[model samples]
Target: MIVTSAPRTKQILREVWRPLALLFVWDVVVTVVYFVLPFRAPSLPLTLFGSVLALFLGFRSNSAYQRWWEGRGLWGLMINASRNLARAARNFLPDGEAVDLKRTIVLRQIAYVHALRCQLRRQSPDQEVLRFLSRGEADFALARTNVANGIVDGTGRRIELARSKGWIDTIQQSSMERVLIDIANAQGGMERLKNTPLPVQYRLVPTLFTHIFCVLLPIGLVETLGVATPLGSTVAGLMFLAALAIGDDLVDPFANTVHDLPLNAMCRTIEIDLLQSIGDPAPDPAAPDKQGVLW
Candidate 1:
C-alpha cells in the first residue's frame, strides 16, 4: 500500500498517460473538423449528461472504496486474533510436553498469517510459510487445496490435544477456539471479496459512458470554445476518466497492486509479535520501500 502523504506525480502519469494522450488527440480532431467542415456543433445536453455520469462514477467509486476498507478491516481482525491465540498458547498451556506444544502453536500462528496472505494474493506460501513448520507438517498442510484453512484445522486439533492431556482446561480450550473462529471468519470475508467482483454493470457501463462522453466533449463545446475546445474538452474528459480509473484501482484490494492492502507488512507484524510472545528472537517490523509502499 502507498504510505506517502500524496502519491508521486510520476506514478500517476505512468498510469494514465496513454488514455490522456488519446483523449487529447481525439479532442484535437473534433476541433479541426468543426473549423474545416460545414458541421454544426450539436447542442448536446452536456451539463445533464455530466451530472448523470458523475453520479454513476461516484456510486462506483464509493462501492470500490468500501470493498477496500472491508478488506483492511478483515486483516485487522486476523492480526488481533493471531496475537490473542499466540498469547493464550503461551499462558494457558502448561509446561512439560506442552512447553514444546506452546512453541509449536506460536510458530504455526505466524505461518498461518503468512499462508493467508499468500492465499489472498494467489501466490505460493512455500517460501514464507515452510520455515515456521516442521517438514512433515508443512507437507501435509501444503497438500491441501486451501493451505491456510488446513493450518487452522491443525491448530484446532493441537488445542484439543492440549485439553485432552490436561495442559489446558475446557474453558481455556473454548476461549482459544473462539479466537480461531474469529480468524476463520476474517479469512472467509477476505476470500469473498477476492473471489466475487463488483457487479458487471457497475464496471462496464461507467467505463463505456465515460469514454463516450469524452469522445463527444469537444464536438459539443467547439462552437463556443473554438480553438480552445481541445484544451477545455481534454481537461473535462480527464476528470471523468480519472474517476473511472480510481474505481478500478480500488476494486480488488488483494490484487498485489500498489493500491492493495499491505498484507506482507501486516503478516510480518504478526510474525514478530507471535515470536516475541514465546521469548524467541523476532525480526524487525516491515518498513515501507523508497516508493513509500509496503507489500
Candidate 2:
C-alpha cells in the first residue's frame, strides 16, 4: 500500500494512462467531426445522462470502498488476536517449560502472520514459515493448499499438547484457545474477501457506460463550445475517467497494488509487538520507501 504523503505520479499514471490517452483521442475525433460536417447532438439530453452517470458511479465507488475497508478491518483484528494469543501464553504458563513454550508459540505466531501475508499475496512462504518451524513441519505446511490455515492448526495442536501436559490450567487453556478461534475467524473473513470479489457484470456496467459517455460527450458539447469543444470535453472526460479509475483500484484490495491494504507492514507490526512481548529485541518497523510503498 502507499504510505507516503505524496504518491509518485509516474507510478499512478502507469495504470490509468491508457484510458486517459483514449479519451484524448476520442475528443479529437469528436472535434474534427463537428468542424468538418456540421453535425451535433443535443447537449441538454446528454448533460442529464451525465448527471445520472455521476450518481451511479458514486454508488459503485462506495461499494468498492466498503469492501476495501472490510478487508483492512479484518487484518486489524488479526493483529490484535496475535498479540492476545501471545499474551495469553505469557500470562498462563509457568517457568521453564512454559518459557520455552511461550517463545515457541510467540515466534510461530509471528511466522503465522508472515505466512498469511504470503498466502494472501499468492506467494510462497519460503523463509518466513521455515524460520519458525522445523524442516518437516515447514515442508508439510508448504505442501498444503492453504499454508496460513495449516500453521494455525499447528498452533492449536500445540496448545492442546500444553494442556494435556498440565502446563497450563483448563481455564488458561480455554482462554488461549478462544484467542486462536478469533484468529481463525479473522483469517476466514479475509480469505472470504480475497475469494469473493464483486461481480464482473456489476463492474462492467458502470465502466462500459462511462466509456461510452466519454466518447460521446464532445459530440453533445461541440455546438456550444465551438472551437473549444475539445478542451472542454478533455476536462470533462478526465473527471469521469478518474472516477472509474478510483473505483477500479479499490474494488480489489488485495491485488498487491499501491491502493491495497499494507499487509506486509501490518505483519511487520505484529512481529515487532509479539517479539517484544516475548523479551526479544524488536526488528525495525516496516516503513515506506522513497516511492512511498510499504511492501
**Which candidate ranks first by TM-score, i.e. highest?**
1
- Mind giving the per-residue lDDT tens digits that candidate 2 earns over 1-295? 7776764677656876798788778878877877898655565578687998998799989999999999889998999999899888888877776688778889888988899888787887878888777787566567778888878888888899899999987888889989999999999988888888888866998999998898778778888887788788888887788788888888878888888989888998998999899888988988887777877
Give per-model TM-scores.
0.98, 0.94
Clashes of 2: 0
**Alpha-carbon shift of residue 137 in model 2 (angstroms):** 3.9
Which has the greatest lDDT?
1
Number of colliding residue pairs in each model: 0, 0
lDDT of each: 0.91, 0.84
What digit string (tens of lDDT, one per residue) describes model 1 on residues 34-121? 8899988889999999999999999999999999999999999999999999889988987777899999889888999899889989
